[model samples]
Target: MIAQDIVIRPIITEKSMQDITKKKYVFEVAKKATKIDVARAVEELFKGAKVQKVNTVHVRGRLKRQGRFEGYTRSWKKAYVQLTADSKPIEFFEGMM
Candidate 1:
């Protein structure tokens, strides 16, 4: 898959924000994408950034009920990308802070 396809979007949350200081960023990635794919995607999407490690989590869909009807939310994959010490941080996330 292409780099943009591999990385859907950045995951910005209170917990994710805390990780930013450690040079770690989180993203919503394609379910079929592997750790290596994520590492490469991040490097290609964010200039001047080097991925040191990639960690993934498969979040199960949660069941929701609206009155009598019930359905499950969409399941998705999350990637935690850690950058090298000397690498520059992702400017996209910096702007959110």
Candidate 2:
């Protein structure tokens, strides 16, 4: 898959945003995307923010049943990107009520 298709979306949460203030950003990424790909994508998307490090995790799908057949939530990858101290953090969602 192309780099554009690798990153699904940023995982925006109060805790994650707090992390962002400290130079970390979490993202829900494609299952097959590697750390290098994630780092590159974030660096590109965030407009020159230097990527200090990239960490990826594999989250297993959860099994569930709704009074009938069982089903599983889709598995996904989570990436925690650390920005360089000199780089500014990205703020796509801020100042919102």
Candidate 3:
């Protein structure tokens, strides 16, 4: 898959925001994406951002209910990308902080 297809989108949340200071960014990756794919994708997508390591997690769908109807959310893969100490921070997330 292409780099754009591997890295889906950034996961912006209270917890994820806090990790930015540590040069760690969270992203919702493709279900089949591996750690190597994520690291390459991040580096390619964000110029000047050199990835040091990548961690991945599989989040299972959660059950939800509304009145008598109930369903589970779609399962997805999450990637934690750590940048090299000397690498510049991703500009996309800079304005968010």
Q: Go through the candidates in order and give each one's C-alpha lDDT.
A: 0.95, 0.82, 0.95
Q: Estimate each model's TM-score.
A: 0.98, 0.86, 0.97
The digit string of per-residue lDDT tens for model 3 on 1-97 reads 9999999899999999999999999999999988998999898999999999999999999999999999999999999999999999998899999
Please report, as a residue range, the 10-residue window in candidate 1 with the lowest summed lDDT.
88-97
1 or 2, greater by TM-score: 1
lDDT of 3: 0.95
lDDT of 2 by residue, 19-79 (tens): 7567888889998788888888887877868999998989899999989899999898999
As a TM-score, model 3 comes out at: 0.97
Given candidate 3, what's the lDDT at residue 49?
97
Task: Look at candidate 2 and tell me the lDDT of residue 13.
Answer: 77
Candidate 2 vs candidate 3: which has greater TM-score?
3
Error of 3 at 17 (Å): 0.7
Q: How close is candidate 1 to the true structure, as a TM-score?
A: 0.98
Stretches of candidate 2 off by over 4 Å are: 93-97
**Considering only N, C-alpha and C atoms within 3 Å, which residue pairs clash in candidate 3?**
none
Candidate 2 clashes: the total is 0
